[model samples]
Target: MSLPKSNLQKIIQVSCAIIVSEDRKILVTQRSASMSLPLKWEFPGGKIEKEESPEQTIVREIKEELNIEISMSNKLPSVTHHYENFSIILIPFICKIEHGEIKLSEHQAFRWLNPNKLLDLDWAEADIPVAQYYLQTLNK
Candidate 1:
């Protein structure tokens, strides 16, 4: 039997950053073991709050999750992926670290990897497309 509309999965919107360093490396974070997709690497950011724009969401998420400030540059293509239980739209922006050091609050670890090396890590399924896009567009 088909599920009720209320029981259907919802599409979540998340704002992520492709944080570029002075040397042009991209920042990726590993999910905490307690998190749903534990130990998988993904770009740093979080779900958008109500009334928040994608830009605002990314800035706030970076501050909250990484304790660093970032200057946003251009936006990349958004990725939408579906899992068995839910779907998510990943909104990614190109950004540079503006200030502060990396401090992990919710993540297990962080890495600054060459864009070409991004695929070497085990990534969250939703974030794979983002990494591939960055590699294809920016790493060329």
Candidate 2:
């Protein structure tokens, strides 16, 4: 089934980060119990605000959500996903932590896991492709 015209026109663009640590682990955050899609693991990120570039969105979101600074390294393929009530264009970028300890304000938990182990968690649907791409291209 397809969405109605009104709903189809309401796609949200989100900027997501695939943060890699010095030890080669990828960072993942769990949604807080009160948040939409609660407790699902996902790459930490947020919706892009008006007039903001995806890169800027990621930088700002990481600071606000994780309380850490990141330097974007590369842009990954973007994924668009549809749900019952909405759709999202997930733009992912590779980033490295530049400063500060992570202090989660919106997430319930966080983990640094090997790329190969990313699928072990119960991931949010929109982030599955991002994880798969990382695993497939890790050595490239």
Candidate 3:
């Protein structure tokens, strides 16, 4: 019932991004003190589980982490980053808020910043490229 050995070796991790905006500012979240990269700000998202599509993962992650619902849209470019412990292929989506006030369940704080100002903050290493793309494409 299982796939071949070649397929077994591949490890695919999934996550999502909620590109929330009001007027021109976008929401960004800070990783919690208990997290590995604590205090560094990141787009709110979490690990995608089995039996869910990327779109479903995005919705679930946002709700779980931010206590808000999002309308999943088209895919954004996937970014890959390697850390000392593990690497992740982050599939970020361009999403809009559907409902609920954002309540931080797993972070220190959240900010609504102009996309250009995104670069000014101390970002988690993995989020840098995604931030750059967001600023370049969405800020203007």
- Candidate 1 structure quality by residue, lDDT tens digits, 1-140: 99988678889999999999999999999999999788999999999999999999999999999999999988999999987788999999999999999999999999999887999999999999998888888645
Question: Candidate 2: which stretches are off by over 4 Å?
Answer: 1-9
Instruction: Estimate candidate 3's alpha-carbon lDDT, on a 0 to 1 scale.
Output: 0.79
| Model 2 / residue 77 / CA error / Å | 0.5
Candidate 3's residue-wise lDDT over 1-140, tens digit each?
Answer: 98876444434566768475757587889988899898999888877788887778878889988898888666778888877667777888877888999888889999888766889999888888887876666546
lDDT of 1 at 2: 97
Local lDDT at 114 for model 3: 75
Ranking by lDDT: 2, 1, 3
Deviation of model 2 at 67, angstroms = 0.6
In model 1, pairs of residues that clash are none
Cα misplacement distance, residue 16 of candidate 2 (Å) = 0.5
Which pairs clash inside model 2? none
The 10-residue segment with the lowest total lDDT in model 1 = 131-140
